[model samples]
Target: MSDKIPEGNRSARERLAQQRERDKGREKRRRTLIVSSAVVGVLALAAVVGLIAANVGKDGDDTASGPAITPSGATGEASLTLPVGASDAPSTLTIWEDFRCPVCAQFENAFRDTITELVEAGQLKVDYHLATIIDGNLGGKGSLRAANAAACAQDVGKFAPYHDVLFRNQPPEPDDAFAKNSRLIELAGEVKGLDTPEFRSCVEEGTHDSWVQKSDTAFREGGFQGTPTALLNGESIFPKKGDEQISVENLKKWVLEANKGKKPGTATPSAAPAS
Candidate 1:
């Protein structure tokens, strides 16, 4: 017998080996495709969930029932709130901000004390317009939920204190911790009577969801540039004259200038919550 197989037999053996290799490669590619498709599906689901959560109160269709917010000194259908201050203050200070905005946090941290003093002294009427721009940007319900919760606090006359506490405990931008109703209720505990069953129910039911939507619409309609937008007597002072950065000193100066030649009324405590 010849050591080598006949030519025809040899050719058959080679073909068998080649076929095996091709089959192996095909199976490997098939597995890779399956895994890749699975990963893509998972990612797609996560993206969808994030979008839905972020858009919770964006459509202005909230029909949750709770105690209605009584508007004593509100504008825009109570979407804009008046902090505890003199009703007829000489200057009107309006701030458009998103709770999840780091820049808004910076603005709040820098001017919170001064702003409180002015409001307490009956020199300025602070009108706060909560916007949800960050939620739209970051794809989470935090901004929307937080704004709604703040409005809920306003319902019980604790808007000013509760507003400060929110900034004080604001989660890092993009974190959805503030979006949780439980977390919002926890923060409300800082304000007396603010964590009541009514408030909790209001927050959970998203009573102010429609109002938050209205506020966002107002912000867009105002034709303003961005969050932490500060206006003095309806004049833009945030980017003062040359876009100069604002500091505590300059902020006060601008306010005083707005009040110049105008007499300030006796400071009356506006709707402050009891401590």
Candidate 2:
């Protein structure tokens, strides 16, 4: 029976190959998609001799309510929202993170939405300071590539989506999964209305690496020397992350305490929860 089916079956297998090509073509047309690599280093861009906003809407952007943030952490209120689009939250919290660091991703996963709400409300501004601490001083090419990809995504107004993609697909070290710029472009294509070609070009040449560069300069000049370091209104905030991870409640209290005229350039003391 097997011998009898041989010629026809062999013919059917060859036809299947043709069908795959047709299917692939149809899928490409049905959905136009592209992604680009995002680098996460600053020094490399400068070493390579590379040099480098806009207003967001109310409703679709932010899901939470808050007040405007000022240079002052002196706001007497617990909550703050922006006057128009930026938050009036009274402080800026900068996070110096490495994409490869699982802890950094954890903190971001738990806080990005809340932080976005604050940024949209103009109550807070969170700047992601990319560093190679996770990848060593060289930080690997992947770090630089991913960081650059992030900058391009930020360009053409696709920062938030690209940001999520980075955290969602953070590479474990500079592995092959990360070396390919195709992966980044693939992720960028997932973002609606994102210009893949422009983004791809930006990432390929490491255009967005400038942000990473400037951030690194700031981190060093500002005297920060640790991973996952948090800075609030220029004051360092040290949160005790344990079995009970940092929550909005804890963040709220930290902000309140930081605002209460605490020591200059230091985190507000965290009090133990009452039983």
Candidate 3:
């Protein structure tokens, strides 16, 4: 018998070897493709995460560029306060609030009449410190823009009425209505003599934006929990005072107690434009 294999058998062996080599090459190429795809996927995911982080940081930041243009008649620390009522009033009510906050609107609406009465009677003065907590939390510019508009109102001695109007016409928490200068100007129409060209210019230009941002930064750094932070004569009064829950009557009582034997304020604040 011959030792050599038959031609047909040899040809079959050669074909099997070629097929095995092709299979190995295919497997190697598939593995390389999978690894490349995985790397690309990871890189894309990382880019998305970085973008999200940047936007989140921007949304939460309260700092602003340019000079902090203190609004007219602003007082107290860093001139971040917008004063309402007599400067010499015996009792001072300090309020930190956000225009877009529903709770803040509720607070203002519930106590608006009482506050107005107290302010008119010279028994109490309010120092409003505006914040953009809603903008930071809910992702909108309404709080900041509305605050700037209110500061514009302050420039024209219309802050109190305009502030009331803004609260009265506040949109839902999710609605960024006040972000539009047109909406802010429209609301200003509710207040007498608040919609002048200068006022419009101020609102449109965001004249006091830097100031509002500074105020927001102060609120963040001030360690307060949230908006509508109310203090009476340097004491916390919102939601509670001592063992008493806050109510209109309780608020009045607290103010009366604090003003006991104290003279009401008589110094009238000038509404001159800030130089």
TM-score on alpha carbons, each prediction:
0.70, 0.54, 0.77
* Local accuracy of candidate 2 as per-residue lDDT tens digits, 1-275: 45465888879987999999999998886554221111122222221221110011101111112332121121122211111123334567866665555556656666677766655544455555555444343234555456557656555545557767777877654353544677878877778866556667766666545445444444445555455666667665433333322455556665556446532222322221211
Summing lDDT over every window of 10 consecutive residues in candidate 1, give the lowest-scoring window: 56-65
Q: Which candidate leads in lDDT? A: 3
The clash count of every prediction, one per candidate, is: 0, 44, 0
**Model 2: how far residue 132 lies from native, Å:** 2.4
Model 3, range 149-176, lDDT digits (tens) per residue?
A: 9999998888888998999999998899
Instruction: Give candidate 3's whole-model lDDT.
Output: 0.82
When 2 and 3 are scored with TM-score, the better candidate is 3
lDDT of each: 0.72, 0.50, 0.82
Find the number of clashing residue pairs for candidate 3: 0
Ranking of predictions according to lDDT: 3, 1, 2
